[model samples]
Target: MPTYEFFCHRCSKPFEVTCSIAEYGRKIKAVKCTKCGSSKVVRRISAFQVQTAKKS
Candidate 1:
């Protein structure tokens, strides 16, 4: 699962949602805001976490 960052226009707040890429693509309609329950949400460009093994 990847954590996606989103911003709510109605609430003027930011939030995050963890879901699979397939599910995200399947979400044709706009995502609902966690705080204000508004569908006017947009995905935000955020950093991703990368895990690398130590060189032993």
Candidate 2:
């Protein structure tokens, strides 16, 4: 599962949704704001961290 960040335009706050890629693609139309329970939410561009193999 991936954590997707979203911002609610109505509530002016941010929230996160955890789901699989397939689930998100299929249910992309069903995302709502957690604060105000509004469907007027937009996905936020968030940074993710990646761990690489350490050099010997």
Candidate 3:
């Protein structure tokens, strides 16, 4: 499973959900806004950091 970030249009809030890749690929439309209980949610691009070791 992977974490996905979403933005709620009804409440103007951001949230995250962890689901299987298969479920995401299938485009399951069951995501709901935790704050406003709205189904109008959009996926957001999440930023991640990668650390590299210094060469000795």
Candidate 4:
């Protein structure tokens, strides 16, 4: 699962969702607004987490 940032076009609110890539893609395709309940949500550019393993 990954975290995604979404901007609500209706209410102009920004939100984050933690879900799978497939789910996220579906949600983004739907573009449903969470705050104003409108199908006009905008997908915002988000930063991905990076992990580094220690060299033992």
Candidate with top lDDT is 2
lDDT of 1: 0.76
Cα-based TM-score, every candidate: 0.70, 0.74, 0.66, 0.61
The collision pairs in model 3 are none
Cα lDDT computed for each candidate against the true fold: 0.76, 0.81, 0.76, 0.67
Candidate 1's TM-score reads: 0.70
- Identify the leading candidate in terms of TM-score: 2
Query: Where does candidate 4 stray beyond 4 Å?
Result: 47-56
Question: What tens digits encode model 2's per-residue C-alpha lDDT throughout 7-39?
Answer: 999989999988898898866679998788999
What are the per-residue Cα lDDT tens digits for candidate 1 across 1-56? 77778899998999988778888876626578989889899887743332222332
**Candidate 3: segments with Cα more than 4 A from true spot:** 48-56
lDDT of 3 by residue, 1-56 (tens): 67778899988999887889878865447888778888899987654411222332
Per-residue alpha-carbon lDDT of candidate 4 for residues 1-56, written as tens digits (9 for 90 to 100): 76677888778889776778768657667756656777777667643332222332
How far is each candidate from the true structure, as Cα RMSD in Å? 5.5, 5.3, 5.9, 5.4
Error of 3 at 3 (Å): 0.6
Clashes of each: 0, 0, 0, 0
> Candidate 1: deviation at residue 17, Å?
1.1
